[model samples]
Target: MEDPSLYFPLPTIKTLLQTFYSSFLFCFLRVFPLCLALLFETLVLVHKWSFLGHLLFVSAVVLYTTLVYHFSRPAPVYLVDFACYKPPSHLQVPLHSFMEHSSRFGCFEKESVEFMGRVIKLSGQGERTSLPPALHYIPPRTGHLDSVEEAHMILFSVMEDLLAKTRVNPSEIDVLVVNCSGFCPSPSLSSMVMHRFKLRDNVKTFSLGGMGCGAGVIAVDVAQTLLKLCSGAQAVVLSTEIMSTGWYSGKERKKLMLNCLFRMGGSAALLQSGPQAARVAKYQLRHMVRTHMGASDRGYFSAMREEDSEGITGVSLERDLMQVAGEILRMNIGALGSRVLPLSEKFWYSFSLFHKRFLDPKTEIYVPNFKLVIHHFCIPPSGKALLRELGKGLRLKKVDLEPALMTLHRFGNQSSSSLWYELAYMEAKGRVKRGDRVWQLGTGSGPKCNSAIWECISPVNPLAKVGSDPAGPWFDCIDEYPIAMDDF
Candidate 1:
């Protein structure tokens, strides 16, 4: 009889050598353990030879490195040799029937009423037979080709507009980055851009899909990183949310909110490694704080809600999401504290530490005195309640959420492009001046909260004014100060 262990016997030297012909496998097997051992030894030596000390030391090093990296990170000041295009505002769904027609595909059953209410509210008190055409989507008759085809079409349309605006030869673009939240298929967005535009064979391209509303910022981060690697590459980034190819969780009110909120929107931004770009909304990327609280799997499951059973449909955010959102904020606060908080706050905490442990030895109190630095705020149009909750959680002032609420009311949640819209609103109002810092926060169903901070480097673009219209200049539009939910 064969020994039980023989059924899973290890390979002999010759067998191992034969199998190790796969270079990648051989390299990992041969090198990874050695590297790990050396790292472990180095870490041990750096500490007092205690496991806990090693862990603390390594964590401190990582934290310090990240802080220094951010502090020393080059602030990008580039002109947006870019143009925004809305496919004939007539494409906008009318307030009376936009949701009725779009939600018939079994996705809008629960929150259709809520969505319709927002649409009507945004249209204003006066009823007009012909409102300006909304940039809208052709509702997907089926979800299969919804995102893939639509993403391609949206990017193509935007690229043509950008190319026309910049008058730059399509071939001159050294790099391309495209991001779509719901639509990613064969020939990823980057490759498709290369093939569609016929760029040089080795043109650098990147496709970021499924990053959700925060993807616009994430794409900016990607472009920022890529720009660091190339000396003279021009990068174009496209962001959109394809509503047509969406999967909806059947009738779940929590899930249906997206159908009511998200609409057709896309923006194409061009970036170059040059200081001249400071004229446009100077792309002075400031601190980017990303925190993943995913280790709390229970917390993850709590916020998990799939628009489709197979997890391939439209994204449905859960209702109990505030709980997860709170956790995410905690993680981000810890991750970003070092970068955003002044040394005074840290010193105060340290003093409190000594006071509690050795001096008073009775209680512990650690309060971080952080001054609010958000000059402009852009948050997801999850809901009025959600916005309110965020304000309370973050201790945000009423003025902070005003722009966000106004945009949500007017645009009905333009998905990833909403922040850009808010940015436009701020510029229109002249709230964003040189050196002002703005924070954009995005929330999605992964119960994800992503934040990006941009520091102004130059004056706002007078010609390319954001959200400017006959209604009024940006400031005039905001005359009704301290916007609140009741106004909407």
Candidate 2:
């Protein structure tokens, strides 16, 4: 079946006419007095009658200038450059190879290994996804090396590519934000980036820790705020997860899901505020909504990393994660709906919610037609089950869910960077169009639902060859995706 987006025509003619009419009206109003003065002189005194033509020419030029000014105003936050970390080929681990290594590590019990096998098969990760170096070795050293490697290895590769691609000088970056859920070093990740780039003395740096998979969006939100506060400033947002320090060596089956789910990946993005940045920026930040349910017990423990029964450390996924996520999504969407949804859609949905709550508790509440607002959705590539649940929850079609699913299959869960890879997949497939609004929803350990909307500014050319970029995660195999996969 063809994608619904394919059948949906671009609003080129309607939007152009609307813009032109508005601009004309505004310019006419402002220049009306000048036109009248010129007319009066031409008719009454017959002197400076040449002023009429000059006035008319000036009016037309000013009108054109006004239209250009309106259209060319800088966005508060604009994406300049973004790059995702792709590990070396030797580090890519297949399912069977990973299983073999886990069995030989002699850390897991027989039952644990079997449980791990089941999770790995159902994980939706491809064979080429990578693991931490300590885990890659035959005898896994359950130590702090994973933390160091994750901090340096992932951040350096992505920042190098992003800065070089965007042609941004380190000194030009006025704001820096970095998020790493598991690893928070002494000087902080943001400080590391500043030190590595040797940024200006007064550069503002912040590191977000323990925010879970949704930390990337939080970083973006922070950048957006700072950009608005300080005009023409550039910001860099980096997100990653260190699975090496998070390795679960214990025999606890429940805590081992991270082993099967997480992979070696990271992403770096550049955002700036100014007409100069907007001229070349790919996407404009539109909206950001965050809902934190950490006060509740279930939410607090949803993805908590604590000592297991045997005093071994690991992150445990709460059994009721989906249920908690559903509640959080409901609240988050309601707040976001009022902001972005059309008035009619919001009124109807609000009526339904009122009826369901007041009239009939058991009555089925209507899900708002989010398709009317969002063109593309970049959801977290957590796992197959969560992906399917979100698709149904948001009422997204198969084509709409393709990016998330394919990202999950090819990259597994790259933690906060998962959504970036998903968005890149859509771009690589040429699905995202100019003026299209994309919604990115990332659920994190805070049991938080972080939502962000980005509007595409410039036309995306998927067929355009990437000349200088390194062999990243999506290279050589983007065309093979969108294949059929089991819903389970």
Candidate 3:
């Protein structure tokens, strides 16, 4: 007979262990009556008094499996907080300096430089942080080599800090998931983390790349599933964007926007399963919603990497990025709201949207009160316009969107890591509290919209004392944020 476990739906397990679980479940479900009959027969064959002994044996086995077995599941997964990197003060690049660099280097024409300047000013990045020694060195600010090194520097630093803060040994980590949108090189980012941390040889590692900025949430979703499927597993998820490799050094006018938007940032989050970790965990994973609107051809190619006429490689942003982002957000919210919203809210939302769609396409579709379900928002700081657009679409207020705006103004677009930085901002300001629900929205290429929900179980613990880290992006500037950086 074929091993039924090979046909199981989960992709997490190894082939050797495939039959172990599937066979157990299949046999247990199908032969429970036979087992009881056999027990009774064994009791009769041995002695009439053996019935109580067999029952006691079965009870002990059940107790041991539930209480003592390490892989025994039905365990809850937990988010044990996370760490966001705050590069040194020297790495800060103000708008003036960046624009000057663009103009001086001839990376952009005068008109292109002006376009970039406007983009930077409207970008809401007050003093964007960058990985040191790369942009600081010379005119060709970033390169392919710098990308790998930057990943090593930031990923290792953040991972070390995370493991140190949580006191979890690298070997104790059973799995590792890394998400880097523009840079997934040989050996993979996940493998790099495994090697750097000296993790166990058999540690399961997965690296996600080219999934766009929303890849972070996607990685979290992957980690969440892995932890639940494989009992007793602990995962470390690293979210980051290495702008060095993705730097648009070319003279393409349309592609120059990428030069202004991306900044260097990364985050490391420790997630685990089991009762032991749940005790000290900071948050509980509630629901994760992901939507990739690939069918929309315009949206799919809204952001992409391609070679210019000059043979210079860069990522080009479509003119309709904001519109595409809005569409993705609408779809994502439609899906997410249904799962988490209260019954009344869901009913009202469905009725409103349905009526608007079928009865009156021109009528206003009621936007559900996301605030009623989610207390805190962690929208990725992709850019200012996109941020405002997403907020308005969700009926999110200024305060609700403050954390994301503040993160952008201070750190620029950290890509996948922007969500974590926003989360850090909320904590630093003492806005997060136990029982508060946080929803993170990420928009990226493939026009993907990704969101994850977390319920805070512990109080906020800032890495730097209320904006005290000398290297912290918000150290001297957080108070000035949520200010109208909109010059338009």
Please name the candidate that would achieve the greatest TM-score relative to the true structure: 3
> Which pairs clash in model 3?
126-409
TM-score of each predicted structure versus truth? 0.68, 0.83, 0.84
The positional error of residue 433 in candidate 1, measured at the CA in angstroms, is 1.2
Model 3, which residues run further than 4 Å from truth? Answer: 1-74, 357-361, 462-488
| Best lDDT among the predictions, by candidate number | 2
Q: Model 3 misses residue 171 by how many Å?
A: 1.3
Clash totals for all candidate models: 9, 0, 1
Candidate 2 Cα misplacement greater than 4 A, ranges? 1-75, 463-467, 470-472
Candidate 3, 117-145: lDDT as tens digits? 88887777776556445765557657667
Q: For candidate 2, which ten residues in a row score worst on lDDT?
A: 5-14
Candidate 1, residues 1-488, lDDT tens digits: the string is: 85543223233343344335345765565555456656776878876586876676567657655644543344353535444334434555555565555555444444565565574555331221111122233333445554565666667777776776556666767668787766677778788778888876656788876667767777776787776543344678877776656535354555555555676566777776544445443646667776555566645655443545545444555555567877786666656656777788767867897899888988755756443455677777655666777776666766777777666655556677677766766765667787777777765545456677777777765345322232222334356533445543
Location of the lowest summed lDDT over 10 successive residues in candidate 1: 125-134
Q: Output the TM-score of candidate 3.
A: 0.84
- Whole-model lDDT per candidate: 0.60, 0.80, 0.77
Pairs with backbone N, CA or C atoms under 3 Å apart (clashes), candidate 1: 78-277, 79-277, 89-133, 89-134, 90-133, 92-134, 247-313, 247-314, 428-474
Best-to-worst ranking by lDDT: 2, 3, 1
Write down the TM-score for model 2. Answer: 0.83
